[model samples]
Target: MKLQTQVPLNKATNQIDYSSQLVVLGSCFANNIGDKLAYYKFRALQNPFGILFHPLAIENLISRAIQQKQYTEEEVFFLNERWQCYDAHSDLSSVRKEELLGSLNSGLLETKLWIAKASHVFITLGTAWTYQLKESGKEVANCHKVPQMVFKKQLLSIDRIVQGLKDMLHLIQAVNTKVKIVLTVSPVRHLKDGFVENQQSKAHLISAVHQIIKTGNATYFPSYELMMDELRDYRFYGNDLVHPNDLAVNYIWEKFKTVWISETSYKTMDEVAAIQKGLDHRPFSQESEKHKEFLKTLGNKITNLQKEYPFMKF
Candidate 1:
């Protein structure tokens, strides 16, 4: 039987059945999760705008929620020239999947709007350890331009992680209370963080996220434990004994597939009607609140638009 649980922050759990208008962010695991959903012919969409490797995108997406513009792949542009998850280091690779998205929108504003329209947002927190720039003292994701040695190996404080999660929840609620969030802690060990320290880092992330997840809301997924328990065996790991091989990603993805694409939780007619009716089209999205009203107005005008602009039906 599929494992199911209900807690405070995460109220219910079991295999998620049916199709969902979902978006994924955080951690490299999201890439795998997105791929599996598509493989199963679900309504899941990878980052509409593009690659988002940082939390700032969370804030940006919420800021644009109230504006009445449709969140499409064309609107969002990436911060860097290119968007990616792993450096050739990851086990799974999908050239076709990588090309499907364009980039993030302008700042947090548009990103929030897209998220508001999404039915589900699944987040995977990859690591507790991050490199903070000495100059800005800010934690950097990717560290592409930032020198590795200039940064010191340190764990993000649990307090910060909790606060970030709380803020994100509020942001998500503001856009669409119906939009549920599933949080997960990635189990891939950090080979560079020392053997013992890597375990400590994983423990830190899992414990902090679990503190909220165990409450029984729809806010978390047991990705960390799933990996540690099911794929932690020596045979499952790669030669480095750090990262899991393609088989591991594939296995975890199958489990994620069962949860996000459940048969019963499929999108309802109302949601489809809204999208089909072109409620997401925002020809004039200036401010965040403006976009919010636009969607509402579009809902009101959906049928009228069909009658008036028959050619615009898309």
Candidate 2:
């Protein structure tokens, strides 16, 4: 008897190969999958503005990037001796306003270029819940430790989420028509919103994603279903009990590979994995002949791989 239910994922019509340039956005889970892509040395740009959990934040960023709109002083504010942009994650915040502006503009330009050429775009929506700045009456991607009283907490309606996703796809397709968009509700639970509320938030996100898929604009990856049904045990959870642990992430990634990644790339992925492992190996005797030999072998392996994949970097 089968102990667990499996998500039936059909092979994608358009598979990801070395030639494919990937752009990943939205949520911490997006980073998790993007990290796997990076590990295999795939050409991927992930979350340039950092983890955006909700659809509106993602929509806002995409609009700004495609429009080539530059961020100004009004969009950024000085807080706790540091400058912060409500549109960006705290990861992009800096002590110097000029540095922050430079980073944001550069990232926006890079993201615009990435979207223009991306073969596949993966979006992982984390929650339906969002916070809007009360003063500006605008939704904030991240509060950046701003006082709670300054924002109005709310859950996005299903209609709004669907509309935001449609806008995101329209903006992307305007720049690149051939891009295949994949949408997934992040398996990571936002329990801080309260357990029941978290479930409601996830339900809303899942519903919105399906609506997008039904319209033939995107495909759905059953990441949330896989986590909930296949890896139902607590062992799949991280120490925080909200995020998936490394093993769980790997499991989901393996499933992703079977469906999305091209089978022809497996051999190259093996070579890349071997090189990664060799590079990560710690030598006890750096001056020893064996260590030197190992280094030479590793160098040769990298050289061979780079010859085949000139874009690959060690």
Candidate 3:
């Protein structure tokens, strides 16, 4: 089936001026847009705990918003309250507790909350391919410890993706009928998927996103197009091309700011880029021969952790 290519917001026959409370969901791409909206001074909420992975997380978050969806009356809990194990020597126990009993879902839930509050919701659909569990058949968190044999790779179809957006639209409208929707695909390549599979997979996502925008009124930002087209030159990519380098994110962000937000938003994303510069920049941290020993220790810890949580899903 044919789909209309989404023009840059500036080129659209009907331009939109939207400033509303925001939430970001879906994939890592939302991280950039969410940061921009916050920089633009829109009331924006990033996923409180961290990025979540599925519909249950989103549903649980909204349920919490409407009521106290906590496991018990205390309301002081972690990601999983059912587990009574505690660690006396761990400083991360508190964080682990919160994650166990808390309401943090996928990053997309952040987008959902933003949709409920904002006049317009911008969604960034990442890869169509998802790693889901075999036993429960649910999508696991990050595919951490999932047995490769037990886990399966799946790609959502155009119809299903469209239906999900429509459903989300209806759900958000139920809470606030005035919310508008903007959709875009993520441009980062998945080295995991062979090149051909990756392109066809992304095309499937772009098709659905494009088809939904064809009805008019709603907007579709060309984040994916800008990245794939304008930023795909070999020089734009990093050593490992799976994730966009900071330069690439900035290039795409500049194009996106002109189309969606403002020059100020562009600057804010730039700040993020600046901060990322020193993430792996520590003097003598890795240069010393100590790194080899450190890696061995780290590997052993990983091995032990895996043994303890073999069924753990990332």
Best by lDDT: 2
lDDT of 2 by residue, 212-278 (tens): 9999999999999999999999999999988999999999999999999999999999999999999
lDDT of 3 by residue, 93-160 (tens): 24454454433323235444555667555566667676666766755435433358877878778887
Worst 10 residues of 2 by lDDT: 1-10
* Higher-ranked by lDDT: 2 or 3: 2
- TM-scores for every predicted model: 0.61, 0.99, 0.64
lDDT of 3 at 267: 48
Global lDDT for candidate 3?
Answer: 0.55
Models sorted by TM-score, best on top: 2, 3, 1
> Which candidate number maximizes TM-score?
2
Model 1 C-alpha lDDT per residue in residues 1-314, reported as the tens digit of each score: 83533221222443443434666766566767776555433445554434333343333343344453333543222334543332111121224333422122232344564576777878777676766657556554545443477666577677666666677777677768777788887667776778887777777666667766765444666776767766657776778876666788877765654554454534432334455545446556457787777677766655564464343333
lDDT of 2: 0.95
Superposed by TM-score, candidate 2 places the C-alpha of residue 281 at a distance from the truth, in angstroms, of 0.6
The better candidate by TM-score, 1 or 3, is: 3
